[model samples]
Target chain A: MIVHSASIEAINKDIHPGMVVADATATLPALKVYNYKEGVCEKLLAELADWAFRFTPVIAVEAPDRLLMDISGCPHLWGGEEQYLADVVAKLKQRGYHANAAIADTIGAAWAAVCYGRPGQIIPPGGQQTALSSWPPAALRLSPLILDRMHRLGFYKIGSFINMPGTVLRRRFGQQLLTRIGQALGTMPEQLTSVLPAVIFQERLPCLEPIRTRTGIDIALKTLLEALSKRLLKESKGLRKAIFKGYRLDGNIQQIDIGTNRPVRNVAHLLQLFSQKIETIRPALGIELFILEAPVVEDLSAQQESLWTALGDSDANTELSNLLDRIAGKVGSAAIRRYLPAEHYWPERSMKISHSISEKPDTLWRVDRPRPICLLEQPEKIEVTVPVPDYPPMLFIYKGLIHKVKKQTGLNVLNANGGWISKRRSGITTALKTNRVRGIGYSGRVNMTKETLNGIYMDFLHDSYEAV
Target chain B: MGQATEIQENVVERLRQEILAMQGLRVPLENELRDTGLGIINNAFPNQTFPVAATHEFISDNAQNGAASSGFMAALLRILMCKGSCLWVSTRCRIFPPALKAFGISPDQMIFIDARTSKDALWIIEEGLKCQTLAAVVGEVQELGFTESRRLQLAVETSRVTGLIHRYGSLPTNVTCVSRWRITPVASIGEPTIPGVGFPGWNVELLKIRNGKPGRWQVAWNPDGFKVVQQPKVIEHLPARKTG
Candidate 1:
């Protein structure tokens, strides 16, 4: 058995990581051991990275217990670089974690400083050379083979290579050693990638006391909405969708989402939309944090009030949109629909509902022909007696009602060759020939069977029939 | 004294005769009707114009008749929806959106609501009527109670938006609507010289009209507008019928 890691006490007893467990057991017969679970360390590192986000938005997690933070402009918020570094390390230590942190001018330098320098070290800007001069070359995070080769060459300290010419080092150790040295000394640039948060218009509030009451949630929501709306107003933008999330003390997250038909920046209106569903969030064990996120935002121009208070140029449109928003909030977004005409001859295909009301129909409605006021979704089959070929039915029975042929006109035969005809045998032809033939006349081929004719008739019956 | 009283009575009688003649002249002005653009049907209404800010109900007995009524409503809406949007509440809307274009109403100007039930549709209609932003509210309902319609009328009275209710398979009962029209599709006027179908025609019956005469007119929708067609004196039978 090999020791994967060692605690401070174990290390104090001269036990170290990667040492043979049997040998350590021989050295200290009563050593306690634990079985390591796979992926637990990485999971903890990820979690630590998430927690570290509270300090700075820019942070990257290095695998196997290492984190890099670009505390460039963040330290001043904590009163200075020294206090900020000390505070982070102290907080982590209080949480029972043995942490080592170092601040430097560069990522490579900071990484080396944290592993080799003092536990809590702050290397001033442009001081990477002096700070890392005494550290071992292994602190540069070089490969084990390179470290062994350097050790054999009697170049133990980074200062030994700091004076070596770049070309010579490149010839002896290749590009990696030169790159590492250059990066540590701040000569070469390195990219530090941080985790990108999904929501940019998100605000979080950590309560001093756990909030469990409905009023508390409402207050938090109002505060968050005010802050968010202020930010939105400054950006000349508005949010259409908002999600309110509550982090309970027990670690469960409860969330509710509200959507608006139009971009909204009014704090009161947004609060009202959320107020309807805010009670649904159950704060079991009390909520510790409130997060409000605007996932969908759009540009919103400031509304100019009408001076006369009468119907102004845009007042009617604005009022209509506001009313629609209110109704949508109550019934749902799908309840409201706006339709536009399509360039199709078929009734159902003739008009299409638009996603938004602002879209205008490209084509005007064709008024050259008379259309039925109501078109059946499907044509109903009817029994008809045609007095003569190519003439409208004299009598028809539809839904068990018999009607004598009335004065008939406007008869147009719909040929089967029309490409727009539905493939489904909906019996529209027969139904139209019998019931709707008087106004907008239709006749099916006499050679077709009753079954196929029924199908075709049904199809036509379902089609939008023009009223004569 | 008797002679003086007789002279006074003769002067009073002359003044009364003059006033009655002036009233007779004013009758033509008061009886002037508002032309509904459709010249054939203007004489049926009191002022010869469709009632504005009033509720009108259109009943259809069958699907074909329902289609005809829908067309009539669309035609009316084209004139009513001048600048504002309209709300259409229905359980199942069968009127083809493109068909509205035939009546000059754009599909984009209409906002449709698919209510889950007839009751919900009525509620939505009432709410829509209460909103002044909408120019009109159209509901295709199977049932509309007298009280429900009265409430709707009150809403429209305040908002001034026209309410057009297209009720299918509904029982004909007395309601407080300004007008109740039943439209049935009839034979369209045929163009014998052009060898094709003419404009759509409807047998429009004003079943119940408030302060208006109830009459039936054979009206055809033309590109220009609705035209009152004279009854054909002779019936012609053709051997071949053109199918659309």
Candidate 2:
């Protein structure tokens, strides 16, 4: 014996176009073709809200595989409720799913019909028990343990359970089981616990005729942006980057993605950002539908000062970032990188190149230091003859250029706190020390007895002495 | 015989000067350069404020379409609009009207010329550079060939204006532009008030400067604008010691 939940929609007694919705098990998946536990089944159905939209926008997936859709005025698009149910079943089968759908006047009767009654039964407003009594106990979607106990009690079918004293059933299985049965049979009102609904961020442009030209695509995109901008503004959200996908009658998706350095909800600004890239997309075979979706949205308060406004117009930084975004979009973001000073002392390892958005140059990064006029990416080992261990070399060759030190300088370290270091997989740790010894063959080693020799730290300070 | 020797001597002097000037010239350390000007960013840029004559050159290697050139130019145009008016010659990517608006740059201030070929792009850039009334000229091309760079360089010198050729990642060849730069994002500064805050700054290397040493520099980019500072001081070349 199995128990199944039911669903129904009723016009509000007070409001003209308002409706009341009820579901016995809103989180449960519709059916158990696959063995999913009651709790896990509920979770899985909740995640399928996006996919459930195929039936109705007002769809709520009941526990297990059941879904209650308030299709009051929605089914005319599918040519009425019976045809709608058939079409839904066909579509689900195409997507590798099995479902039982029914239409009824009360939520409880609809649940009974879909679970135990035949696939096509339509329960008129007051016919809940007439439709539900003949179904098996298993149709109620109750816990198998409870269903087995009810069977052992000799109440094997839904009609038997209905005929037995409701008081005796309550005294036997706890109140929830009987209440679920009563709710499915229209004896009690059912309540649904709603899940997080799918977020609909798409802006659609349905062209009366196919758009084949770049200009036409531009017009369609502009129309969509205008519409979407208003929605985003109303939501106090801004789009930073969006993908514009064009759908051809042949079902091919042509997508072009555009990005904004800052989140924008202004229609004009959004239009200008995409104008050039739109030419890159050929209408190939023509597009009949256009959809713009912003995958990333930011909380945008229009009152917040624009970066340009905050900087007060004396800065080129905003302009430069916009340029970087454009270049990164075309040549790949990796091609444009800013040099960030690393914590290591090694010349080659002292700097790292990261994507333009990661590290920002601050006032402290500009602190002065004695850096080689021309620092090679990698230090080339050169043969040098020093007068002694602690003396600056009179002459040294680098890249085959021998330059005599006009003024000699010993190591000097600029003391300051390191700026923000981002999380990367493997690199120099920020806590590492830097040791710089500038004299010829300068070597300073810490005592091994101090603790542990994790790694070497070198900091070069400006040491200037006259070369003899 | 005297005239021929004199001509050879003059050529030698010029070549020597060029080499010496190319080597060891450091960009002047002007603390004020980062400031640019006051009231310039907020009032001028979005309103198309800068005059055309104050433009600067932007160099990228590949002039091809969909290369970083247009993006590079757009960013600069965004900056130039901070100060004045701008004309952009787009050879590679199609200009979308909506994207420009999204960036907050006035659509009315921008005139986009689509050049079918690289030759046409260079010619347009050269002409735009010569116009004193425009704030900047961005030439979108696939390759700013040596000859093309020389011609554009001459135009920049004559107009006393900036002309940027948007190129790809390839380093510039023998052709000299006023300044060679690559736009990369600097590490954003983390803020105590705000968790992850980096107002986009650039690690700008003066790859080739007429009067500046080619060293790495960092500049913070804010909506207010770009501000340059010296690159962070780090320990110079030192060998890693082998630990026992």
**Candidate number achieving the greatest DockQ relative to the actual structure:** 1
C-alpha-based local distance difference test score of model 1 = 0.71
Interface quality of candidate 2 as DockQ: 0.04
The lDDT values for all models are 0.71, 0.52
TM-score of each: 0.55, 0.39
Q: C-alpha displacement of A192 in model 1, angstroms?
A: 7.8
The candidate scoring highest on lDDT is 1
- Model 1 chain A scores worst on lDDT over the 10 consecutive residues at A446-455
Chain A TM-scores, one per candidate? 0.48, 0.45
Q: Candidate 2 docking: what grade?
A: incorrect
Displacement of the residue A397 alpha carbon in candidate 1, Å: 9.6
lDDT of 2 by residue, B40-152 (tens): 22122211222222223445432121222233345456655655445566554344322233234554455455556676567667766765445577665657676777777
Stretches of candidate 2 off by over 4 Å are A1-141, A144-198, A304-328, A332-363, A366-368, A412-468, B1-244
